[model samples]
Target: MLRVADIFGRFPQLETEQLILRKMRKDDARDLYEYASDPDVSRHTLWNAHRSLLDSQRFLEAVIEQYKSKEVTNWGIEHKADRKFIGTCGFVYWNPDHRRAEIGYALSKSYWNQGIMSEAAHAVMQFGFKKMLLNRLEARCNVENIGSERVMQKIGMTYEGTIREQLLIRGKFEDVKLYSILRSEVSLEC
Candidate 1:
């Protein structure tokens, strides 16, 4: 039995060659805002581009609440080279009995094509399967999000199917592509 309390008791800090996946702090609002507020970043997602720092702050506050209860794991990706907080990745949802969880993430537009998200997501996937003992980890993204789909593929997740008009993003219904990787299928190498 996985206890949320136990998970929160010991904060999980994960690291990759060029990035660190850790808790999102209040101080991260500035960097978070830098990318999250960009129109390009939110274009394919359900949420709209943030208009101000307050929006990022409010989002951080909500994330902090989840951290307090350990209901979900969210990590802010930190680039060790420049010490810049680039983006975030983590388990957005989980089911203990089924040993399954849904992973989600976003990276700054400036950091795209750098394979940074793959590193961060790989670490998170390892934690979910090895530490959280998850049997299946899944990810979903807008069907038009090629970059996001690439990130999923880089982490060994296979494209399962597509959900038609599942997400009402911006003002229209958007199709979503689903991907998944079973515990036995996870490959930490690379």
Candidate 2:
């Protein structure tokens, strides 16, 4: 029997005033489906928004595999009030040579307007730049994703540039706005 603690050994369960950020698990699929199945939750995300329970299952499988392989740093975001998995927050594209990483996140709509994502971002960004020793952290969002942009800003990441038609999403070219925060700069903010 694999204890959840045995496989993970207690990842950093960061806490803010009202949220929790920690390692994700395969068992979270059922609780996560409540939000992961919503199109709105993944709309601005690079991955095509999940549309069904099966889609969420595939996602959960990938996340579980990622943990087992120690590939990327991904954290699940949960709201303390309800003890629910609202979304994920973490750095994905890690470049040790460049000392940089790419961050991505998604949260359920029910938790929007509550500033939970911003708190999660702050904690994760700190872990990446300071604890993980990353020199640069980047976040990109669809140009129309004002909410995501705001979260980046709240975490003190600087808006850097926009890549026109940088990605193809659902068969259409989409513009992406890039933001960056260097370890030196992030340290000042912290």
Candidate 3:
């Protein structure tokens, strides 16, 4: 029985060979703005491209508050070598009763096609199943988002199917491809 408080009492920090996944700070606004302001990075995401640094600051403010309230939030993905905030990855929704959760992520365009997102997603999925005791972990991406779909596949999630008009993004209904991986399907080891 996972409660928001139980899992988010303290935001967990995760790491990989090239990235550090942790709670975001105010100082990350510049880095967040750097990528989030790019239309290419926000094109496939539901959120609009940030118009200014204030937009990123406002977003961080909300996330910081969400952390205090133990609400669903994401981890800031920091590139180890650059020590820059390059993206975010975490559970966007969790269903304790069903032991299921949905993950979401976004990465800077410069970091794309380098397997950075796959490594980060793998860590988040492992946390969902092992720490949260989730029976099912799922992810969904716009049908046209090949990069996102590849991340899902790289992490071993099976594509279920495309749902017609599954999400309203940027004022338009968009079809989405759903993918999921069960606990039994994962090795559950580092």
Q: What TM-score fits each model? A: 0.95, 0.88, 0.98
Considering every candidate listed, which one attains the maximal TM-score? Answer: 3
lDDT of 3: 0.95
On residues 1-190, what C-alpha lDDT tens digit does candidate 1 reach at each position? 9876666656788888999888888999999999999999988876678899999999889888888876776788999998999998998888888999999988899999999999888888988888778999999999889999999999999999999989887678889999999988876444
Cα error, residue 93 of model 2, in Å, equals 0.8
So what's the TM-score on candidate 1?
0.95
Leading candidate by lDDT: 3
Q: Against the correct fold, how does model 3 do in TM-score?
A: 0.98
**What shift in Å separates residue 26 of candidate 2 from its native position after superposition?**
2.5
What would the TM-score be for candidate 2 when compared with the true structure?
0.88
Measured with C-alpha atoms, the lDDT of residue 164 in candidate 3 is 100
With a 3 Å backbone cut-off (N, CA, C), the pairs that clash in candidate 3 are none
lDDT for residue 177 in candidate 2, whole number 0-100: 96
lDDT for residue 44 in candidate 1, whole number 0-100: 81
lDDT of 2 by residue, 1-190 (tens): 2233332344567777788887787777877788876778778766765567677788888877777766666789878898888898887677666677888888888888788889888888887765567788999999999999999999899999999999898888999999999877865335
Q: Which of candidates 1 and 2 reaches a greater TM-score?
A: 1
